[model samples]
Target: SGSRAVTIDTTPPGAPVITSVMDNMGTVTGDIANGGRTDDTTPTLNGTAEANSIVRVYNGTTLLGSVQASGTGAWSYTPTA
Candidate 1:
């Protein structure tokens, strides 16, 4: 006789919210407005997601990068290019 235990999660995490986008490479570094423009090549993105979840950042259809959310559900990502 053999026994095994397994666990499954069906509930999905809440949608991520982009709190702010900062131009780290710009001469005048600051947060970029919702529809604003920037000359920064590698901007920093701040957001929130489910704790310990994988947060993926994308540009239109292209995947930029992925980061793990902190225990408080906070995450940040900066594109390399």
Candidate 2:
């Protein structure tokens, strides 16, 4: 329906942080100009992170939730509204 810019914090090496962020809830529809683009899917989280690392989803400096990283240095998370 609309676009939202997700700010990712990448600082304080000793602390858990976000390296990169993507725009959330963007419009993706199949139309005449787009040719074949559609909005039937969402983004998937799949990556490796350090143990005890915390992944936080935010809406501009507001901490949404904390996701604990796996013991094998892997953390995958999906944010829900």
Best-matching candidate per TM-score:
1
lDDT of each: 0.90, 0.53
Clashing residue pairs in candidate 1 (N, C-alpha, C atoms within 3 angstroms) = none
lDDT per residue as tens, model 1, 1-81: 899898899888788889999997757879999998899988899999998889988889898889999999999998897
Which 10-residue span in candidate 2 carries the lowest summed lDDT?
29-38
lDDT by residue for model 2 (1-81), tens? 999999999865454544333333457532212233324333334455667677665659987555778786566555665
Best by lDDT: 1
Q: Where does candidate 1 stray beyond 4 Å?
A: 1-9
Steric overlap count per candidate? 0, 0
Least lDDT summed over 10 consecutive residues: which range in candidate 1? 21-30
lDDT comparing candidate 2 with the true structure: 0.53
